[model samples]
Target: MTAAKTETFTSLAASVLDIEARSVSDLKRYLDANFTRACECLLACKGRVIVLGMGKSGHIGGKIAATLASTGTPAFFVHPGEASHGDLGMITSDDVVLAISNSGETGEVLSIAPLIKRRGAHLISMTGNPQSTLAELADVHICIAVEQEACPLGLAPTSSTTATLAMGDALAVALLHARGFTADDFAMSHPGGSLGRRLLLHIHDVMHKGERMPLVNADASLSDALLEMSRKGLGMTGIVDAQQRLVGVFTDGDLRRILDQRIDVHQAQIDRVMTRNPITISADVLAAEGLKLMEDRKINGLFAVDDAQKPVGALNMHDLLKAGVM
Candidate 1:
């Protein structure tokens, strides 16, 4: 492209960004008692929150529905065109219908609004014009008005769509907080994602248990503990009392510290050179918590203990890395 054309394109892009940013900021004016009522309505909904829209608004509504679903609200999106044909059956008396239209006069959306009300479902309209037909028909109206479109022709739905999406996010997040939604709750809806792995995976899910655990009797020699660590390849070995309860942990770092002291590895008891009363996490705790514990302690390995303080499993940083928990 010519230099002149490139400069023109860059200037247009900057102007679009500035306009969209202001449009989103301008949405602050729309959050009133109605917004709270909308959130409270969704919170009290015994059925799903059904979102409806046409064209570009439909695309944005789908994303809004997905966000709400992932964040603890039960929601889904149905196209207005589809709703007119038969998809209106998806809504119920206990449900709440959220309709989106930039101009508030989308024919398809209007065609289904009365049927939705007749079905006993509450209606919430999101639009750029509050006085329009669809807005006036709603039990609650959220305005997503923008001063102007980013499209130079002023015919496209740029700034308006951005404001609508931001308003949707505001609603979802408000409901999320009101419902006491947590990371674990969010993770449940997204089990295939990385956040799910971090929030849902427990130490027992990745630790080496049973015969794979590296453990030695408290009376065992340091050399014996080293052999167990080498065999198990965990870089550490847990020391247990005669009752099979964990008493201490001997790691490669301890070996390094003791090497200069000239301690007799052959005759030294495992518990003598081990870290006494080491930090321990229960097997049922989240792997992410275990990772945080290890990082805070600056340690490379950990032992998962049962109620009796006996080592049930063992793991190191490498195992966490392999399990995608790091």
Candidate 2:
């Protein structure tokens, strides 16, 4: 690369690092009484947190609103410009408003401040300019001031936006902890996601049960067990005794080992070649736990046992992969 291009790239990188570092450091100054009051107000709010902003701040507010909603706080973003054009009706007396603007003087946000106050909603302004109109009119003000922007021109929202986003995350997580939100609650909110599948899908939900399960008697001949494994297409089969309780497991590996021993697959009994005391998982366990167990044991499959030690179901690595937990 040319020296001029290299110098320009190096300068940009240093500027970005400096801006982000200072933005994070500036957070310590804002985490005082004002931040405490903001958290308390949000915790006390019986309704949703209505986030409002304009331009670049509006984009940041949308992400903050989504983060809050997913982390146990009910929240939504409203464009300040749109709020004046009939969107103001979304705000009620019971809600809390979080207005974002780096300068604290964005015309759209300033225009809506009086109406937000008239609606009896608590206004919390996040801005770099504490003495500006929006901050002065707010019930609580959060300072997101930055020493400089990453842009060489010093006019972009880089550092200020980062600070605002981090502060919003801090608030959301604190509220999540105070509300005693659990993993199950998070799963409920994200039911269609992979996290929900990992937390909510149980072994029983994915295991092969009834006639779909592959099985063979412990006294059955090796040839018959091989037929069972082939018929079921699970690459393995459970070996049970007269009481219908699992005694051992026969797999493709066992077939290879028996062939290595020169044992007659047609004449040898499955009990003699099957794996005794095979590892099993409970039917009630989560699919995530089952996946972990398989990983730890270095096995591709496991039998699901009932409380009475009966072979209730079967599962394999393919099942977990298909379920999106792999």
RMSD of each: 2.2, 1.4
lDDT, model 2, position 136 = 98
Residue-by-residue lDDT tens digits, candidate 1, 65-109? 999999888999999888877888889999999999999999999
The TM-score between candidate 1 and the true structure equals 0.91
Q: What is candidate 2's lDDT per residue for 1-326, written digit by digit as tens?
A: 89999999988899798879888887988898998899999999989999998888999999999989998899999998889999999999999999999999899999989999999999999999989998999999999888888877888778888888998898899899999999988988887899999988999999999987899888899899999889887889999999999989988887887788999888899999899999999999999999999899888889999877789999899999999887
Clashes of each: 0, 0
What lDDT does each candidate get?
Answer: 0.92, 0.91
Worst 10 residues of 2 by lDDT: 148-157
What lDDT does candidate 1 reach at residue 195? 81
Q: Say which candidate scores most in TM-score.
A: 2
